[model samples]
Target: MIHSCPLLRSLTLLLLMAGLTFSCQTRNSSDNTTEQTAALPPAPNFNADSAYAFVARQVAFGPRVPNSAAHVQTGNYLVETLKKYGFTVTEQPFTATTYDGKKLNARNIIGSYNPQASKRIMLASHWDSRPFADADSTQKNSPVPGANDGASGVGVLLEIARVLSQDSTKLSLGVDLVFFDAEDWGNSAVATDAYAGFCLGSQYWAANRHIPNYTAYFGVLLDMVGAKGATFPKEGYSTKNANEVVRNVWTTASQLGYSTYFIDQQGPSITDDHVPVNEIAKFPMIDIIHMQVNNLSQTFFKEWHTTEDDMDTIDPATLKAVGQTLIQVLYNEAQPVI
Candidate 1:
């Protein structure tokens, strides 16, 4: 998440209930009427251990700071891991100038399943760790470990890729697992540009997609999703831009009995990678990020952007909830025509 004192201060608290009801609109030729119905599909088992291991591996590389050796190694590792899982991988490499006016080498790694299919689903997460632990008073200048913030989402996606590779027959729509870099480099506190630095890789990818004229049925971004007792309230921008997608995902989570983790409440909007994907790419996307109420940090998770955000803070149960919910959503999606 992007952090600015003003943005955090401007958070509007709103809450809404998330129920387990699936609605589908059916149009009738007579009188141009429409009807809605509900349906539930069986979901595959998501292994929490596997997802946990992936997060651990990323953290083991040390902080994935942009232009750092750890960042390059982590990027290569992600690309190779996806390829191992039978995904057609593509790397979008570019240079981005941070808010502090430092040019950094960034890459957006994409793993595609069923590359021939036109209808697709995009799952995204940032793979870069923050350069500074700004939120931690003890080590404000130290780099964040980013196990939960940066690696958690990617770890879940990697596990999803592994699960999907085991059985492509479960899904009809193609899938793209995107790992964006340089997402944590922005400082809303001092940046003069409204949209610069943060989410640099996503902004670039959205403006210049790997495939020409690329589009997706919908996209889901996972951010800071593996903290113990984490809660994911519906983010403001998601409701404003992709309310239907948000509903579908929340409903799916509820049906799977993960309502506690996937809270049915409206949350404050924050700057995230999905912002650029929605605005620049013009795609419907929702972020499944952790959120907290009445917190001094004004962050979703307790260890956000801090040195404490390490493997010790990771929880397998949280990973399982999110991973299982995503698997169900993908498997239940209708086949869109190519």
Candidate 2:
């Protein structure tokens, strides 16, 4: 989740639902065709249990806050694991100044497959958990376990890397899996400048990409995706900045029969890593983040930024829903040779 410190006094709340409807109508007319009924491709076998275990493995490493031993060890684990999965792993180590003037040693890990292919897709998620559970009433100053928030998305991506390694022929396009650090090291709720402290690793990567002049067809960022019961509505910034990308992901989710988890509703604008990717990297990027419409909390999942976001809340089914959808999307993009 991105932070918005001191509140933007001039920013207006953009009602995304209405904007999506209009955009859909325009897209449908321009396409002028019903949804294609291509034979459903073979199901990409994404194992939920394996993904769950990956999440658990990260939690066992303790809180991966930046500048800590746990953070360094976990970063190494990610690099080695991806290398074992047949990816050409690259690590970008940099120092970032946090909102409160703390310099953090952050690493952005990138794993590339089929680097020769010109058509590429990027998938990313932040690996560092927030240092302070500022949102939790009882443990306002304590660090969150971040099982669902931090580890979940990385787990799914790691599992995807594993599958890609087992069957290289399954992927035709180049794929890059990026694990960004220091995303959650941001200002507290009481801070004067919120967004200033967040997404440090991504901000750095956007400015200095792993591969010089690197470009992707599109990118997707996953966050809070392993909650027991999660809903992914179209984020406002995604719709405004990358409407086509959002449509593609939502359509793929629907075709995979995961429509219940990927609802058609529009969520509020979020200040996630995708924002910098879209604005700076110039990639049309979308965010698959958990949001609850009926819940009283408007921003994110229930245990967001709380100590309760531990391993107990990491549900395998939710991981499966997200991982399978991502696999299906990638497979759909794979063009078979004539």
Candidate 3:
């Protein structure tokens, strides 16, 4: 969920500048480029059904509202599943106060593959569903199922982890799959301070990184990515903050014949978790979120923050498009000098 308020608009621009500086520096480094092309691995097969099943599992757990029993249980499920997939798991537990003055017991789950490699990429998604279906006309005050909003991105990442574990020898660079909590507990649209309440877990992680001095080649965030016939236009903040990263991912998506889904159009600026990661953590991060150019509301996907965000709205094809694109991107990156 996002509010395009004037104050947030100004802050978004400043954040974009800071992100561009870091992203440009990374791309300009001579070490990142090589005259001789390296032999890239075959693209790993992305299983859409597996990804869809993962999304279903999250929805089956019910709405994972922060501080709720479902939220805690779902966190445990993520940790155990990642461990099963041969990832080195770490949990960052913290307390955050929301705009409504409620204290949340939040946890950020980190899963690492090939931790020994210096060249790394970070993939992230918010796991907690929004507590209110403010965008639903019928159930405006109810909690959302968030099958696409919260679970879709994590489902894709979990499937990636499973594939990586199955064929560990194929990967050349390290991967960190992070599932952030309390991302959807922000204030409703009617609130006076909407932006302040959003992305609580990401803000905490940015200020205090799980690993000291943690750095990655680049980071990609997925949100509202599992809806049927979803289209991921170039988000405004991503274009301003990490244009190169956006180009890289969109290029890969096009090459994979996903051009129809990853359209080359500018999307509205959103104050998501990636915003804090770009501003505070200084990571060259971009968001691959669903947006519609012709929609009545300018914020997000059709069923966003609504009770209709249930499993039926999720599509395996969209998950495959995004998951396959990331696999291709990682496989193309040159291994860092040890």
List all candidate RMSDs to the true structure.
Answer: 12.9, 13.1, 14.3
lDDT of 3 at 6: 68
lDDT, residue 124, model 1: 95
Per-prediction TM-score: 0.86, 0.86, 0.85
What lDDT is reached at residue 265 by model 1? Answer: 89
Better of 2 and 3 by TM-score: 2
Ranking by TM-score: 2, 1, 3
lDDT, candidate 3, 1-338, per-residue tens: 34355664687786887798888888776334332122334667899999999999999999999888889889999999999998999899999888878899999999999988888899999999999898888888888999999899999999999998997456878999989889987765544553558898998999888899898888999999998889999998899989999999997787677988999898888888899889889979999999887777555777888899999899899999999999888877844445
- Per-residue lDDT of 1-338 in model 2, one digit per residue for the tens? 33454565434344454576789999996554334424546646899999999999999899998888888889999999999998999999999887778899999999998888899999999999999898899888888889988899999999999988887455779999999888997774544553557888898999999999798999999999999779999999999999998998898887676889999998888888998899889989899999998776457888889999999898999999999989888887886645
In each prediction, how many residue pairs overlap at the backbone (N, C-alpha, C within less than 3 A)? 0, 1, 0
Q: For model 3, where is the 10-residue window of minimal lDDT?
A: 31-40
RMSD of 3: 14.3
Model 2, 260: alpha-carbon shift in Å? 0.7
lDDT of each: 0.87, 0.88, 0.87
Alpha-carbon runs more than 4 Å astray in model 1: 1-39, 168-170, 335-338
Q: Candidate 3 lDDT (Cα, whole model)?
A: 0.87
Candidate 3, residue 35: Cα displacement in angstroms equals 20
